[model samples]
Target: GRLLNALAATGNEKYLEGFGPPAPGYKHAPLNNTNVVRDMVDDETAGILVEPIQGEGGIRATTTQFLKDLRAICDEFGLLLFYDEIHTGFGRTGKMWGYEWSGVKPDVAAIAKGMGGGFPIGAFMATEKAAVGMVPGTHGSTYGGNPLATGVANAVLDELLKPGFIDDVAKKGEYLKGQLEGLVKRHPSVYTEQRGMGFLQGIQCAPAVPAGDMVNRLQSLGMLVPPAGENVVRIFPALIADKAALDEGIDILGKAAQSFEAAKAAE
Candidate 1:
């Protein structure tokens, strides 16, 4: 797969270790965040890579315990912790960085998505000790630190770090999850379950209902949700979204699921 290819190019040959696909009854499923990292990493490994909460991988949330274990393992082996918080940064997961929820910090991390607040931007931060060998000009992006991009990113961060901004995101995330859970309970025929942390949520629909079909239905209803690798629909609304907006969005999703079910029955 593309992921395997990309990883290979960056870090030499790597093997495919299967991961759990988000689906029916995943809430009770064993959390394997740390286990997977341990299985793959050893003394010679430089670092462990992870997404505290997987976005495109269907809003899958890594457990706090798993994160703690990863931190411990990394210390044990003198390995760096690298987080891909692209979709979970900028208070998207009710925190400035999703890794904070795990009470674990990474030596190096890449962040984007919410950092732009609709503008295009990306960044990678690292602890100097872990970046010991990354000399000047070792790696560069044509536009990585352009003045304009930096200015815009600064503005976005200014707003996000403002007092109560992240707290509001946390409140709204809980409220949104509450609403989605309600819908899941009310429409078990359509949604088998829900999983995610903070605003990065997913609704697992029937396996018979392809994720794309659900997204298209939601789009037709004037709402947009992204699909994941499995039969999961992702909800990555803006960080500033309020309860009212979240309620409306969830309502649209519920209706879309119902519509999909009706159409499926017809078929």
Candidate 2:
């Protein structure tokens, strides 16, 4: 839950002002700042939307207090609270929902990514009370209700909810976290620290090493993971991944880190 205040993905409205003029009235609280959210609420404010675990923003965890405070603020203001759980949904975190750690239920939530099981599918859910305004024609998608997509999503959801599935994911995640932390300790010249929950995790590369360079090094060693903004290499593994698989990834990371350290020292 070390949510630091960082800008959003580049070119976003709040991120460098979308590389142009800003939107008329859009506003955002620094990632972990509670005051911004509080001050921004008013008659024109709709609600608050956020990612419990920021995947692209360096796998930053949302503090339990921060999430709970948002919930309380929304309730007090008679406003909706929404969650964009696409990245952290479906057991990416130890919990089924990133907000579940705080036990705050959102009025509306959007989910996708892992839910599709490699297919293209997405869904938005609103509590019965919050859904009253989202009538049939109010909002819909061209591919939203496809039978095949729904079928695949259902199968994926069923597997994720099966007994002991998420528990195993949590166990694997702890193991993986140890592996990443080990890299940080043993290869400090390359990675400064490890952060994240479950299979969704990241390691911050040192200033001397570029995250993209580390990513290429890992890929060359037979592991593939994307780079998160602000020089982070995300450690995203399959939900059903095992020790051997994670060990392979860690081994690759170790080799890559050593290589980067050696290169840095040479420089």
Candidate 3:
């Protein structure tokens, strides 16, 4: 628990205030930098934890080479590789796991959110060797394995695993990304670019257009695009959204960007 808090501290100094001293074993490295990661590791290092696709950090996705390098580094140093797949797991990325895209597996992975299908549940899966020390009584939570939650997760999995469901998600993601790219080109004054994959997309607002302003504008247009770090507006659609729904959302997004561009020109 303290370790997780310590890890949080590495993300922001404010996280450590009133939380007492952070545990000393963790280190933070820039995303996609293999050199810094390797340099940071040593005899005291136990593992590396990362989000395959950073959600709150502005929808930044790790490169395939970066993940592969992380795995290689972990293996060379006899350390574990952990993935925080809370956002990118369970078909959000058009794959069962975001790490699947890189073909690099983690020794342990923390997954939740979509897995529960709106139910409250979170879990960590470990490899055989990683789980050796995790026998009964080693670790757990009060509501760790609630039957109702597990049942709901199973029901959700049934739909996600159906033939062509994930493939269709991939197809839809490409379509969404293309449309967003076109939006960026059409309103360069409002949006600089688009980031992310699958249903977890983001449009980065230009410096002249704050992400919060765009989010508010979209919300008023009957669409909800949440703002993320680095002036990004996240466009996470429901997995079940069809082409018509996506087109409608894209149209609304274009409208929002156009409105911002128009307001800027008016000034």
Specify the highest-lDDT model's number: 3
**Pick by TM-score: 2 or 3, better one:** 3
Q: What lDDT tens digits, residue by residue, belong to model 1 across residues 141-241?
A: 77778888788889998999899999888888888788888888987878887888678888888777788888888888999778874588998788877
Runs of candidate 1 exceeding 4 Å displacement: 1-36, 264-267
How does residue 24 of candidate 2 score in lDDT?
46
lDDT of each residue in 58-109, candidate 2, tens digit only: 8887888888899999999998998988888888887887777778889998
Q: What's the lDDT for candidate 1?
A: 0.76
Q: Model 3, stretches more than 4 Å misplaced?
A: 1-10, 13-23
lDDT of candidate 1 at residue 143, scale 0 to 100: 78
Q: Report per-prediction Cα RMSD to one decimal.
A: 6.2, 4.1, 1.9
Candidate 2 residues lying further than 4 Å off, grouped into runs, are 1-24
lDDT of 1 at 215: 85
